[model samples]
Target: MAHTAEIQCPRSISEEDRARAQFYQLLGTLLSAPPSSELLRGLASLQGDETLLGVASRNLAALAERTNPQDAEREYNTLFIGVSRGELLPYASYYLTGFLNEKPLAELRTDLMARGIKPRSNVHEPEDHLSTLCEIMAGIITGEFPCDRNLISQKAFFDAHLAKWAALFFTDLEKAQSAVFYTPVGSLGRVFMAIETDAFAIQ
Candidate 1:
C-alpha cells in the first residue's frame, strides 16, 4: 500500500489533465499513510486562488504550516488505525455495502485486471481502498494504463467505482471527531468530488 511507481506517459498530456492527476495523487498520498515531515513542509508551501477548491487548499496549507509530523501521525492513527478499528473506514466496499472486501471490491479487482492495473505486491489491503482508487484514477489520467486515455474512459471508471460514495466518505472524514489536519483534506475531497461529478455529468 505504501509503494507507488513512477509512470512515464506515452503521449502528451494537457496541463488541465496533469493538474487533475496531481490532485488525485495528492489525495492518495495523504490518505495512504501519515504525512512525513517533508510532506508536511511541502504542503505548507502550497498557495491557492479564489476558487472553492483553492480556498480549501489554502486552508489545508495553513493547517499544514502549524502541524508537526508527530501530531499529524497521531491524528492519522486515531482516524484510521485505532486499537480495534479506526474512527473511519476509508474503503469503498464498506461505504457502499456496510462491509469490507465484498462485491464492490470484487468488481474493482475485475475492472483493474481489465485495465492492466494491478496493486503492488506488498499491498495487503483490498483494491476498494479509497486511496488505491484515487491512485488508479491518477494513473488513468496520466496515461499510465493500457486502456484509452479520454474523458469517456475516465467517466466510466469514476461512475463505476467512486461516484457512488466518495463524497459521503469525504463528508464523514470532515466530521470525524479525530480530524484536525485532515479536516481540510476532507473539505478538499468533498469539493473536488462535486466538481468531478458535475464535469462528468456534462460529458
Candidate 2:
C-alpha cells in the first residue's frame, strides 16, 4: 500500500481504541514494505506478555533480533514479490474471487468513497490489498476518515471487507515455504485477527 496522510488520534480516545489502531498500523507498515534496519531494531526491542498474541509478538521480536535488513528484504521479496509472482497474492479480491480487481475490490472502493477515504494519487494497487485494508482500518479507528469512530463502524467495515478472508490469508502466510522472518508476523496477524473477530462479535 502506498503511504496515506498521517493520522493523529485525539487525546480523548480510549486506550483500547488507541492500542487497536496502533496494531493495525504496525501490520500495515510491515506488510506494505520490508522493514528497514531501524524498524527491525525497534521490533527486536519489543517484549510481549503470556497471551497467544503476546507469544507471537515475542517470537517476532526474537526473529527480528536475528534478522538483518538485507535478509529480511530478500525474504520479503520471495514471499510477496518474485521473478514472476510471489508465493501469495495478498488481496481480498484474489483471496475471495481467485482474481485481481474483482467484486470485492469494487465494493471496498465504494465503501471507501462513502467514508471520504481516498487513495493517494500515486497508489496503483487496489484498495482491497491486505496492507491497504489494514491501513484503512487504522484510519477508521483513529478518526482519519469521515465515518463514526466507534466499534459499530469498525465492526461493519471489518465484517464486510476483512472478516471473510484476512485470517485465512494470514494462515497462508504462516505456512508459506518462503516464510522466515515473516513466519511470526503471520502468527501475530492470525492471532490478532481472531482477537478482533471475537471482540467484534461481542460488540
Candidate 3:
C-alpha cells in the first residue's frame, strides 16, 4: 500500500517476462496513485482474454468508479492512519529487526545509493518503504536496474526485506476491517508474493 515509485521496464526482456513485469509495474503504479478517471480508462482497456490480472484490472476499474468517496476515505485512514497504527507495519526495518528505522533501513539505503536508486523527492517515507521495495523487486526481475538481478541478489534482498513481512502485510490487508475493493487486491498480492518466494527459492 506504500507504493510510490515509477519503475520503467527494459525493452530487452523476453515477451513472456515482459508481460509479467508489466503486471507488477501496473500494480505498483495503481497503488502509487489514488484512482483517477484516466487510470479508470486505462484499466478498462486492459486485455482480459486469459489473465487474472486483466480481470482484476477490469474489476478494479469498475470498483473505482462506483467507490463512494466517504468509504474510500475511511478505508484509506483505517489502513494507513489508524487511530494508533495499522495492524501491518510495512517497513523494512520493522520486519527484519523487529524495530523501526533500524540497521536494515540503513543497509538498504546503502545498496540503493550504490545502484543509483533514490527515493522520489515527494516521498516522505524511509528509503526501504514497502512500495519502493516492490518497485525494486519488479525492477530487479525485469533488469531495469543497471546490473542483472541474479538469484543471489534477489534472494538476499527479498529475504532481508519482503520475504519476512510481505505475506503478513498482505494478510492484514486481506482482513482489514475497512477493506472492500482492496481485499481481492490483498489476496492477489498474498498469493503472488508466496509464489514469487517459492519460485526464487527453487531457482
By lDDT, who's the top model here?
A: 1
How many clashing pairs per prediction, in order?
A: 0, 0, 0
- lDDT of all the models against the reference? 0.90, 0.89, 0.66
Can you give the TM-score per candidate against the true fold?
Answer: 0.95, 0.95, 0.75
lDDT for 48 (candidate 1): 92
The runs of at least 3 residues in candidate 3 whose Cα sits more than 4 Å from the true structure, single-residue gaps closed, are: 1-10, 44-65, 68-70, 83-87, 150-152
> What tens digits encode model 3's per-residue C-alpha lDDT throughout 1-203?
23223455544767766665665666565444445556656654554434554455555656666665566656666676678985556677887678889998888888776665656566677766666687777777677666456667667767876787777777777787777766656665676677678877887
RMSD (CA, Å), each prediction: 1.7, 1.7, 4.0
Off by over 4 Å in 1: 1-9
Q: Indicate the worst ten consecutive residues by lDDT in candidate 1.
A: 1-10
- Between candidates 1 and 3, name the one with more favorable TM-score: 1
In model 2, the clashing pairs are: none
* Steric clash pairs (candidate 3): none
Better of 1 and 2 by lDDT: 1
- Residues 27-122 of candidate 2 have per-residue lDDT tens digits of 988888999999999999988999998999999999999999999999999988898989998999999999999999899988887777778998
